[model samples]
Target: MEHIRNFCIIAHIDHGKSTLADRLLDMTNAISEREKMDQVLDNMDLERERGITIKSHAVQMYYKFEGKEYTLNLIDTPGHVDFSYEVSRAIAACEGALLIVDASQGIQAQTISNLYLALEHDLEIIPVLNKIDLPSANPEEVSDQIIDLIGCKREDIIPASGKTGQGVDKILEAIVKRIPAPKGDPNAPLQALIFDSVYNPYRGIEAYFKVVNGTIRKGQRVKFMATDKVYNADEIGILQLKQYPKDEISAGDVGYIVSGIKDAREVKVGDTITSADNPADAPIEGFEEVKPMVFAGVYPVEIDQYEELRSSLEKLRLNDASLTFEPESSAALGFGFRCGFLGMLHMEIVQERLDREFNMDVITTVPNVSYIAYMKKDPTVPVKVNNPADFPDPVKLDRIEEPYIKAQIISKSEYVGSIMKLCIDKRGILKNQVYLTSDRVELTFEMPLAEIVFDFYDRLKSISRGYASFDYYPIGYRESDLVKVDILINGDPVDALSALVHRSNAYDIGRKMCEKLKELIPRQQFVIAIQAAIGSKIIARETISALRKDVTAKCYGGDITRKRKLLEKQKEGKKRMKQIGSVEIPQKAFLAVLKLND
Candidate 1:
């Protein structure tokens, strides 16, 4: 156990965490030259295409230091804020973390937040300034920032270039010397913490875990404490580039187990795995509950495939434990699931995976944040509302409270004014601001979670020329004057398109939604009236003209009255059709209306 060093790499998005991981694997001879590749831990196609780590990957490596062979288990974690849950899981299973900071970018918002998380878990922190080879890299400036952030000595910070393999040996030496080995009793009852799990069509659900005590052997009976379900460890192994089967994995080692449990709900992340006969007294604690930051409805393109969609989501959820869903039906989109996501990126990635991995055609409605409404009749009772259609009537509602978040943005000083303006326009209040350096500033704001659900991230990136990094966490709920904006197509309310909006910005958003729907909804044989309404009042309206079939074409060279009669007849037909026509809302329009700023 003394020679086993378990640690993880963490950083802001695109801060060279994966690159540094590659160099560590290369120097340690973990992977053969033929197996070397960029972002080797990231195996998913969606992760590769987006150049982001949507999932946390764990691998075991063997390193020799001073003639003594050491077992190093490194878990590579995602840097995006939406995937912070993955980072938290990795931290719970590790003894230390390598806090990677970009030399040129210095310390960003995510870096600070992730550092706080690692600190909270009492993990040893090793600050490594990455990207030292870039011409724009300012190692000295970043080193000072790291010192201030973590209170580490100047020489303790290692300056390394992940791309060129510089300081790779030094990093390995630090990991061996600074990060302590896992401490546990091999003679005690089996207590393993399951940090992650994946589904396999051929075998079953495989759960990846770290053994805190005792030994787990192949073909042994195990029980997940959370589910209280027992299964035989059909296969037990350590995770390398591939699964290396082993007879047993003892204390202080990271490994995986396959029990042939086909049901996805049978396995849960953060659950404790114990020996079925000699079970541990209690489950491991400190596992943070996942709080979803965004909500949206996901409906199948074909209504009959609802069950298939539900099954696919279950399997997907087995892989991604952060995803939460409940069965919901929409008058406009039919039966669907109301899904909760970590953020916009997480939501988009889930949508993409549903299409590519499961081949399930789905329609996603506009995303929104959860709210709480109090009834006038029962002032003490608070009703949770995620769907706008679930909102209570204004006459019966006492007040509404929306979720607020503390947003932290690190950017250049030049874009401070613009960033502040954008946040204020979204009904945000400036909470605090500080200069990390003469040219770099950290701005903090308190804003509604719903405000940032749409295009806030994109706008911030554009205004800052991609120089800013944003991170946020919920700050609970606050009273607000919010209204539900119901979208009506030809006098029929479309429940899927309805949204809760702040009363101050309701009119402008309503106008934009009406115009966007006008452009996205295909022209039908009858004229369509699109209106954005708040109860009895229609705040905005747009009309989509009918696709005309000229009945007057055959009246050419005839009497003027005949031509007029043909035109009149066509107009009467359109009016009749309009009365009976049902407007078909295209899938693209559901997403486009959310991007009003774009």
Candidate 2:
């Protein structure tokens, strides 16, 4: 149909993409006035709690204007830099993109980055200025910035506040006039691009895709181009901000198809679904596997909860394809999972969900960057090391390459000197700087990805008094003199507490780690010494303060049971610590020391 349009909403984090999607649905009467919902497309609890979309969601709506009916397929995309690859895949599945910019914040670094991605995909860009109802709204300046940055015409900018549903009609009209309708043959072999998928216990695997050619029906058999798996489409439906059963879906329509797929590994996010009998010749291009940048181990607070933790991870991964985990064993923790994530935000979201949603208490190790280990004698046998304890000796390392990023920061000019100092301290190289406004300036730098993976953003915010916004993208790998620092409790090396540090930062990292360990380790019955050493030389050392006295005053004839229980508990806690030979260490102490805030 000529009136059908497929598009997606793109914006920076907190720029109101989901809210705008909700308003558009309401304007089209897709949901009744009495059934109005907040962020209807953000179906996951973690997404709602974080106020950010982790996965791209799809919905269909019907709108009539000037006696013409239009079938609109609206896709909501994640705006955080951690999911940039997913955002790119979503843009590829659409014919047009609505760029939502915050009216008060002007053009942010992520806004420019996402806009560039949309432009690269050659999607028809319809710039919409959102949050115009805010007290500090500046639509005129934002419109000018959009024109200058994206080279869009001045009249192309549509100002609206998704909160109040203002100027939203203009956005719908622009979609019809500026964005071209889907061009495909409804009679040809079926070809659908699966942009997202989820797993449900009752219904199995549900995949959401957009039909580019032909038609898909409930009883039809389909095959995935990427995995070559075949299945009979048990059900077909359209998303009206909620699942609505449909007999069939034609070209340019976005909907979901459910089958008996129980394993999530079979249904990938970017896989293509086509007719089994008359499949398309080739799969849709531009889908790449997402690679996680940060790796950490998640251990349960209680040893008996191992199975529960594993089950929780499985269920969480079923809904989120980006989160990854593998079974890991530790001498101290016994059984745990080594989890991988796209970035720091992704790791935090997963951890928070495990605690709040699943009701599981977990202790996580420090996050680490992946490394490639090269041996002198066996140069061809390169080992991929995710944990610092796995790194080979210094003599075996020929060269080390670490991931780098192109970082950008927007802040007031008054804090320029402090920002510069912080960047230099992190071994960052200044790339460029520009004044966005009279008081606002943007600084670009090339820095090690590992440096900012922890709390660099938080530190920057504190120094700037919450006046700065930061964003970064992976550039490539660069050669650096990096070594693995192993921490020892008494005599035995604690693998979970080890870290990879540049040669220049070894001393500072060691000192910071010792201080954190002092605070994390409680006063012991006997004095315990913590030391960070390289080779046979000690770089940093600290002693935990000894306990003043034992609780002997509460002991009595009947209280003997309670005293014995307390002493047993204390001994049990000591046994969990890795025994180097004579020194007693606590497992919690190692975990706490690994997290160096400074």
lDDT of 1 by residue, 485-559 (tens): 999999999999898999998999999999999989999998889999999899999999889887887766957
Off by over 4 Å in 2: 302-311, 356-359, 378-382, 548-595
Q: Which runs of model 1 end up more than 4 angstroms from their true locations?
A: 557-560
Cα-lDDT of candidate 2: 0.83
What TM-score do all the candidates reach, one by one?
0.99, 0.90
Scored by CA lDDT, what does every candidate get?
A: 0.93, 0.83
Which clashing pairs does model 2 show?
A: none
lDDT of 1 at 171: 93
